[model samples]
Target: MATSLFKEILFRKKITDDLNVGERKIIIFDEANNGNMGDQAIVYAQTEFIKKNFPTDRILHFSIAESIGILKH
Candidate 1:
């Protein structure tokens, strides 16, 4: 189990290292259009978190009512 976990961590690190901010695209999916404030808040929080952590990566948000849209910084 420990060896498997270590392999997973190393694989993740390799993927992270290969990612380029200019070429990386992150898509966040949510059900915010169902009139749920909590869902909206979660999406908002996630967007903020991603922006904070991956400052240069492109972020896309998709909700139930709308199609794919790019997140503005």
Candidate 2:
């Protein structure tokens, strides 16, 4: 299971690396603002991490539990 998971990660990394940043669209689905402090913090951290790593890519986030959509730069 661990080996498969590692391979999946590497495959995803390769796919992401091959994509053009200018045309890439990243969608983040999380349980955001659902009255769970931990979930909220996780979502916030994920958003910041993505923004920091992919500064030029378009990022869209949606609350999987609440259907709240957020478009972030």
Candidate 3:
């Protein structure tokens, strides 16, 4: 839906709006959920991939609910 897409954009903007220019950071979204094993494995693989490829940049985690909550403003 358009509203969902709009909320996603707003939430992403909210999370990154305060960052400085040329920030070297990677955000892993929805990895903080209490999901099943498949989801956990996906998160683990993503983390390992980022760690292997981008050893210097900082990593950040955010949940889907948390992202949508930011759009409630």
Candidate that scores best on lDDT: 3
Winner on lDDT between 1 and 2 is 2
Q: Candidate 2 — which residues are off by over 4 angstroms?
A: 1-22, 65-73
lDDT of 2 at 1: 56
lDDT of 2 by residue, 1-73 (tens): 5545433443544644534346877777554667889888898888899899999877655456423222221
The local distance difference test score of each candidate is 0.59, 0.60, 0.70
Residue pairs with clashing backbones, model 1: none
* Candidate 3, residue 24: how far the Cα is off, in Å: 1.2
The parts of candidate 3 lying over 4 Å away from their true place are 1-23, 71-73
* RMSD after CA superposition, every candidate: 12.0, 10.8, 6.0
| Candidate 3 C-alpha lDDT tens digits along 1-73 | 6556645664675754545558688877656577688888888888899999999987777667765654464
lDDT of 3: 0.70
Q: Give residue 15's error in model 2 in angstroms.
A: 24
Q: lDDT tens string, model 1, 1-73? A: 5545433443543544444346876776543766678887888888899999999877755565333221221
Say which prediction, candidate 2 or candidate 3, comes out ahead on TM-score: 3
